[model samples]
Target: MTSRRPLPPPLELPKPGFGRRTPPALFQPIMGLFGLGLGWRAAAGAFGVTPAIGDLILGATSILFLYTFAAYLAKPLRRPATFMEDLRVLPGRAGLSAASLCLMLFAVVLAPYASGLATGLTLLAFAVHVGLVVAITLAILRGPEEGRVVTPVFHLSYVGFIIGGLAANALGYPEIARWLLWSMLLPAGLIWGASARQLLTRVPPAPLRPLLAIHLAPASLFTMVAAGAGLQAPAYAFSALAAAILIALVVSARWLVTAGFSPLWGAFTFPLAAFASALVTLSQGQGAMSGIGGIALVAATLVVPWVAYRVFKLWPGGKLAAKTNAAEA
Candidate 1:
């Protein structure tokens, strides 16, 4: 009998060009936070508080935005089909929502300096975000629960809607903004209540534990938006609630850390940034709160860069993608 040759290893196919090697949408909040950091610092300078730092951050923000926007442009070109496929999934869909909000927030942050251009961009961003919110909401309501899991990312959909409204206010569309703002309360309330119940009742899998940080988002965002809209009592209430949630999360830091590094860790960045932004906004003229805002700003300043570094380091090598795939498996 002739000896049979061992079968050659299965041929490995090259990755498709259109889809993200990692998730493109994951970069949304990172870029947004960078914009916010610079925007806040610039605002401080415009107010005569830290001209040098503001100038430095503004320069950095411009450079960073060019880099990120270039990368954003490349995603669809690389894998148009894969990009579309991602949007069909829950987390991927949420990422799209976050992307629109990122644009909205970035525009809002820059509106003071670039009033005309920023206002136009903000309106465009708001329209896109609201459209996505409605589409995603309807899809979720109508679609069967096949692969859907109630993770914190789902909150991004409604969060984008709320942020859009806030951005509209910043762009001087007060009536439209007020309507969007009031519309948010019922949906936001329902989402927060449901998410809280889910988290308390069931422990999220290891891959998703990092999403616990998202619990801080709604409260923090509401605080900022309420303060911006002159709703002082609601702003204070949300601020207190945000602080409580933040404290609880900090207390459980060990558990979250044990989940290890995944792209999901990016979830931690924007919420903290939002909380810091809220504090800064609320502290505008209050002496005692200004110190707290300063401290929060410093923390956000450090945290965002570190997280961005970690994400980039992992992303280029496919390390985060591998971990995420394994966790999902």
Candidate 2:
């Protein structure tokens, strides 16, 4: 008997719209670049570095955010279902949460120039973020049993309330920020414990190893919050913890990127920026970890742009959009 050729694979057609094509994962790099700017500003405040350096980075970052946000905002207008659908995935859940955090940070950025607008964005961010967390929780429980497994990005969803606290603190609402930060610690601790158990049991796939970097972000952010609260003892403890985490991650760097570049590289951005900024904050110009912080600041400054370029390139070619397959006529 003659052997017949196997049927061909389906031809894929991508979803429409450049905005719809852009994945939420891209937001992580935006947040990272913004964090880098803030890191420099922290250095300037603590030491004698130029505030202009940070201001320049921040101004550029704002422009980038407007462009990215405008593009992403178009997704919902083009296809609301597609927008909602994205929230079901790991990158979508984490990236959009990062975006909400981005909005909160933007509120602080806009505060000096337009207090009213700043307040409005902060409220909008809070509502959007909390709603996202609820929706994600429900989605995981309802279906897509695949998403139920805990992973490093869970840190972004659960521990990121620190950014809201940071924004509140910046807007002269320290009491509210204090409440938010203190409350955040419980969830952050829970996620860390759960994630550690999962990670220890199975090494994440190569593409996902980069997300392991997210483990460092919460501690770094809490250090800043504790320092702001004048809880020096706690701040020092958190700072030490962040340092150890960073060292461990650095040692594992070879394996983390063994899968090569992916949108997940965005996971590497904010934690380093936060840790660097935290080090600068704790230094208080005393020349403690400021040198190491500067090194991290430089690393982040270089890394964010590279990741942004890689992710944005995906949008231009429609590589980011979902594709549909149909039988050939």
| Best-matching candidate per lDDT | 2
Model 2, span 267-326: residue lDDT tens: 898898989888888777677577887777788888877887786676566564432110
Candidate 2 TM-score over all chains jointly: 0.89
Clashing pairs in 2: none
lDDT tens readout by residue for model 1, 1-329: 99999999999753554324545545644544654564366348333476566556545655655465565456666645544455566556755666777677667657667879887887787788777767676666566785455556666776556776566667776666666667777766777788789777877677668777877877777777777777789889888998898889889888887868666677788777777767777767367666666676678778776776776676554565454431110
lDDT scores for all predictions?
0.66, 0.78
Error of 2 at 173 (Å): 1.8
Model 1 compared with the native: what TM-score? Answer: 0.82
Task: Give per-model TM-scores.
Answer: 0.82, 0.89
Angstrom error at residue 38, model 1: 5.8
| RMSD versus native structure for model 2 | 4.6
Clashes of each: 5, 0
